[model samples]
Target chain A: MTTAGSPLVGSSGRGRVGRRRARNRERLVSAAAELMAEAGVEGVTVSAITERADLGAGTFYNYFQSRDGIVDAVVAGAVETLGQRLDALTQGMADAAEIYSSSLRHLMRTAVTDPLWGRLVVRLGIAHDQLIATLGPRARRDLLIGVDSGRFQVPDVDIATAITFGALLSAIHAHLGSDQASDPSGVFAESLLRMVGIPAEEATEITQRPLPPLPSLEEARVILGGDAEG
Target chain B: MTTAGSPLVGSSGRGRVGRRRARNRERLVSAAAELMAEAGVEGVTVSAITERADLGAGTFYNYFQSRDGIVDAVVAGAVETLGQRLDALTQGMADAAEIYSSSLRHLMRTAVTDPLWGRLVVRLGIAHDQLIATLGPRARRDLLIGVDSGRFQVPDVDIATAITFGALLSAIHAHLGSDQASDPSGVFAESLLRMVGIPAEEATEITQRPLPPLPSLEEARVILGGDAEG
Candidate 1:
């Protein structure tokens, strides 16, 4: 009989070891993220991550091809998480204020909780050509849906996506880097919503409370077509 | 008597020598910008800049304190130019769309024609904390005036400033880096205008024509507040 977790396990005693290997990879990524937050990107190294995760140097190599490979994995994981959260936040929102507020709050909470991820995004957005190129298309598609439904208004969906993402990342970077008065997340979200033209009174109310309901998936699809489906 | 050009012409026989020093400084900065664009930040060095500018090794030191200093000066000059242009674009505009269109067009032109400066800003925005700190306040004040005047309908001036600046810079970086498109400036400006809540049709029209006239100094003070006489 075949089993779901049998590929690595079927060969001798390798099955049990494969589960451990997967766990170890998760541990290493988590450890690397913690270190990056405390000491910035320069602080992460294979030796340090392995030590933090209580794994051997050999074990680290088994999971990742190189230090950069580990970083790439971590970054990819963070981006995926961010994308999922953003999708959830705007999924049903019909009102522009509600949509903007939910997105701002979601982004702020993510950035505050995982500042290293925020910093990594900002750094990559500016310095790494390949990564930004990959992320740009999906982001543009989302913005276009927002624009088409009147939940957002922009002259060009592509450019607005680039700017909004850039600004959001930069704000998080600044907030994390500073000791300024006020809640960083609140400040970051509030500012971004206003810049994109959500009314001040509406922005204040949304930021303070839970987001209102949005269009159903079908309704959104009717308005935004294939782009909204994504 | 000391005159405006006095610094350009040093006392005694040093006047001719001073001109030579100024010329060398200009050449070094220009060379550094070129090298940075061609090779990325890591590839630039004093030797490389000097060689590219056709100056001797000894000539480089006469002006810059170090390679970092050259980078600082080059960044400062570019930012100063950007600031001046923005100021000029906003000098007399009454409507938000006009201001947005004018400022964005100038910015787009700068990004396309002088891509090196755009890259420098992105790098500095990511790596240099102090530079961002200094520019943040001035940017906030400018944004606030627009908000108060109803030229912009943002909820939070501070957040709006961050988003506006961040979006512009990010879009420019993407445009310069991409090989898939042509003339991204119009699209970029239109995106920004739309984000600020301007109607799409109006944004497109303004972006295609000359920007609205900038406010005179007197009018600017009235709108911005503070010393009307100053």
Candidate 2:
């Protein structure tokens, strides 16, 4: 309802419109995120998102060009933000192998505690470029650090990164599906650490070390710099 | 159409009806598999299956009770059949590590040679239980063999199995996504062998050894001894 130059509409009207637009976009993103958690990335459609948001089909187009647009927005907001937070969370660590092990342990722990988050990422599968783009480089960076310091034996960094990413999803999926009483974070991280050429015993020891907590969203925002919004 | 107690319909009618049912079901499986490969497991639906099968919506129910039913049939058919064939192909191998490596290499090579097969399994994602059920036990069995032989250092068999399954999908996803001219089979197997506790140089050598051909369908049937239908 705001016009650039109108006799009747004033600056306050533009401010109200801007706030409404932001709120509506947030609604769409939330709806998409929830739907993706329930029904993988491919399951999220524009009509479904608009319906979930209680907005008109036309409103969806105004906010997002397509399903992919909204998916990227969701992944960027959630997964990428978490990636940055994990990055910020581990920056003070000195050990290359611990950095990698700690990051993986935290990822599995997060998935175990938050089933919705785990399902969304697991459902995104391997072809999900946004998910990979967020997590891949960070994983690669951690592995390279391990390799450079001679703390881990990573013969192929790209292959190792791909395995780490995939194994995380699979382990989360396995834990979610199974009813066995097991500490997944420790074992999963241990397996991956070994995969990267850490001996089994040392990998186990590294993963067993007290895990530092992830920063709260507010703390992560301040620590990572700038608005966390993608 | 034939009725169980219809004298006039006879055995020929029953035979014709059975053949027709088999043909219709095959159409549905092929349709569902194609849709799954294109749209992922969550994307395949009853209407989509029927439409792609060139059958009426009601006809879909005549064969499969729901989308899950048809999806299971598709996964069991394509994926499980491959698993059995893999079993038949490697039954006589002396080295447990070679058995494991050869199987993984074949899987990667199949995916590389056949993109559709690769996409269908990857799109199935991590949560598809039937996919896991078919592949999990075999991976576990291979790991157990390695463990029992004292050739591989597997601290936890279950976790290693999960990693192997996840890494296969992830590596295939990586190879399909990238244009990298890397031998995914050797590198992937090498990484996994290292992960399971083989030393780097030795793991590299094992993966580099000769790989025998997988059994053809006819050969697999004779070798496996039974109808391969799940």
Candidate 3:
């Protein structure tokens, strides 16, 4: 307890102690993500995580209380920033259909371009508790927007949310499994739009629309409350 | 190393040794099913299975090569009979859409009525390798039927199959999580039918059509190659 001088509770954001704490925490999360990507959610252990992070044994306990705690952090670190990015991208979009389509397309595009992201998503799969916790509300929120706008004929938001989630993960699984050339973002979202009662032509048009570029992960870290980038 | 007089491979189907072998295998499968339903796929260990079956430890290896071998047996034992029953029910049905709808409705109804089945399906989820192995091809076959009949507007059969699998498991998870009164089978199938390009009104009507009684599990066991009912 003599660490009253520790940077964990430093008054200055730029202080040495504050910087060290953030760096250590980031290292732990990155190591956790790497391990999860390689071996899946169930395969990870705290000792493995600390070892991979190059931290001393028991160092993980200072950052995360348990394996589940770090898992939540890993998922939150991935999904929350993406959620924020999507929100910013669609900040002023009036059309709910476009908003929904844009978010899905971007998600698929990210998975396509980022092998690590794709592996993490495919490994976690659809029934992952942390993934669902992080992504479910965002999906439901988007569905409700489409419903409220008179643009969708959804029978039930909850069921639609479930279907959307399942579709995204399963589509990702199939997309990654295949060597065929096709835009998963367009095809996957178009199918979903139609399911929610969007007309065929419109669904196709919306999903195929050009997507805005996603912010770099380093920038997203800042947006997610991490310290400034190098 | 079997006892000299034991009939592990007796020629006569009606012989005492043949009967004992079938009985023992059936007991092991039933015990495995109980453990899986009570816990989950990951929770079932060889020792736990043997303990549950009340058989000597080595008897498990006599029946199943390993835990995975038995897990496959458990999923195949559950899914294959259901697949066979659906085939029989839809054999003469010309309407591809109706055939697809009927199969989904029966699945959901089984989950609703059979809590054990529901728990197992929800626990296994869509990422389950064995569940997908057993159900994936069947799902693709039905989607192909609808596509060939010009009754379904499927963009990609593979993606559609993935969605169907995902939606079914996630919906089941939601259904079991909630205490709602609405018909899950009807709503879930209707939504999927629309996703595959069925008209909303038609999809609703098809999903709401009177569902025929599913063959009982005992009957299913017989259809799946277990012995006749007592």
- lDDT string, candidate 3, A1-230, tens digits: 11111112323557776688777887888888888878787789999999998999889998888999887777766765576667667656898888888888887776776656666766776667778876788889988888888988988889888888877877776677778377678888888889999888888888878877765544444454544221
- TM-score of each model's chain B: 0.74, 0.87, 0.84
lDDT of 1 by residue, A1-230 (tens): 01011121222355666767766777887777666545545558889989988888778888889888877666655654344445555766666555555665666666666556666666555555544654565556656665677666555566666776677776766666656444555545554454455555555666777543333334444555466332
Q: Residue A211 lDDT in model 1?
A: 41
State the fnat of model 1: 0.54
Clashes found in each candidate (C-alpha, N, C closer than 3 A): 12, 0, 1
How far residue A67's Cα lies from its native spot in candidate 1, in Å, is 3.5
- Docking tier of model 3: it is medium
* Tens-digit lDDT string for candidate 3 (B29-140): 7787778877777788898888887888888988789888887777766765566667667766798888889888888877777766777766666667778876788889
lDDT of 3: 0.75
Q: What's the true lDDT of residue B160 in model 2? A: 84
Predictions ranked by lDDT, top down? 2, 3, 1
User: What lDDT tens digits, residue by residue, belong to model 2 across residues A1-230?
Assistant: 01000111112545767867877887888788889988877677889989998999889988777888888777766676677668878888899888898899988887777777787788887778878888988999999998899888877888889999899888888877777467689888887888888888898899999999987555776776775533
Q: After superposition, how far is residue A9 of candidate 1 from its true place, in Å?
A: 16
Instruction: Record all residue pairs in model 2 with backbone atoms less than 3 Å apart, i.e. clashing.
Output: none
DockQ of 1: 0.34
